[model samples]
Target: MLALSAVHETLGKILEPPTLHTAVIFTPAGQLVSWQSNPLCAKDDVHLVIGLSGDAWQGAREKGYGMVHHNHLGKILVVPVEDVERKPGEDKPPLMLLALNATDEMEWADMQVKGKALGAALTKSWSKHREHLTVPKPPQSSVAILTGSKRVTTR
Candidate 1:
């Protein structure tokens, strides 16, 4: 599993000055996996941003924008943490990065460089701890097959 401190340190190195109010790693379904916040940040604000940002990212993809590697939405920055080994046309990744700025001071150029670094770190973490991080689904029920009036259950 990725350490919370490591995530905090990486987020800290992304932007300076006004500083980031909060940063979070979440699932495609909008479940928060991990987060870090500055002393001045409110937990409610962080949760709200994560929920909204997850929706924004999903909307972008559904609207034919394709996978948005990074988005600069005023005071918010959303970046997808993609698997480097993913093949074309595969399902969308399960994790994303969302950062809330103290103000609308984040520059696109700066964010590109820093966001990639943060995303790469997250990707590495994902690859290393994929089994542990993934949510386990219940086994599927057997399907019934009818052949020549005989019914058989098959997995």
Candidate 2:
């Protein structure tokens, strides 16, 4: 939980100007461990589980564009305000939702050069704090197979 908080704080500071409206960290079981920001919509609508189950996350991952940081594995769904209509009596102003799929590999290279370094730094710090978080280990056979070649695997 502390790790998530750290990430939220760090990212919030880094991503200036067009600030992030919300940031959540969920467990593998779909429990919302920690979060930062105003959740204007219903819980189920912004649930991490739903995001993961959808094709958007899978498509991003398959294209090597997963999480903002390379350490965690998850999807980032950027929902612009213009795309959604405001509800009646909802006084809160609409802001873009920056969902970070923490379970996915951090894809810093995909980000702008100015933001890449900060993202990398955050990923490094977050990894240290969340040392208990388990990352999927690469298959040993794959490492051996690629030992002498520059060819990449497509799967």
Candidate 3:
């Protein structure tokens, strides 16, 4: 499991003014894994990150940029915590989404640098504590499979 204090310290070292209104790590499915935020930050803000992350991820993959979007609330930057260069036969690492509620003061250059730094830190953390992080179980869904004239249900 990721320590809240570690997250705060990492963000503090990277962002301008070294403050975090909201910092969260979530799964691809928008499951909140760990977070730290200021008093002004609402838990509901996580929903916003979830929304931003999904879109930004797609946009970034398409455009090949680091900082995806910036709005009135803050900026959204996501980096893959996984090491994509794994050895053959090794399972691919899970990506940890890093979303920050950073204000405009953090310019594009600064934000890109911070995003890389944060990604490095998180990648290390992910490797060290891979088993500790929560792995959301896949939702059980009944799938219908046809066998000749019969229908079978499988989860």
Using lDDT as the measure, which candidate wins?
3
Q: What would the TM-score be for candidate 3 when compared with the true structure?
A: 0.64
Better of 1 and 2 by lDDT: 1
Candidate 2 Cα lDDT to native: 0.39
Better of 2 and 3 by lDDT: 3
* Pairs of residues at least 3 apart in sequence or in different chains that clash in candidate 2: 69-106, 70-106, 72-104, 73-102, 73-103, 73-104, 73-105, 74-101, 74-104, 75-101
Q: Which 10-residue span in candidate 1 carries the lowest summed lDDT?
A: 64-73
Candidate 3 per-residue C-alpha lDDT over 1-155 given as tens digits, one digit per residue, 9 for 90 to 100:
66777766665554343344566677755777666665446767767876786678656743333354546567777655665454555544356677666776666566656666777777875666655664745456866678999998788
- Against the hidden reference, what TM-scores do the models get? 0.67, 0.38, 0.64
Taking all chains together, the TM-score of candidate 1 against the true structure is 0.67
Index of the highest-TM-score prediction? 1
Clash statistics: count for each candidate: 0, 10, 0
Model 2 per-residue lDDT tens digits across residues 39-146: 333566447433552334344533322333322333344221111333555533212123443223333343333233443454444444333544345676665235
For residues 1-155, could you state the per-residue lDDT of candidate 1 as single tens digits?
57777776776655455544556677665677666665556667667767666766667743321122224323555677767676767774545555444455555456555555777777876765655666655368867668998998888
Q: lDDT order of candidates, best first?
A: 3, 1, 2
lDDT of 3 at 63: 36
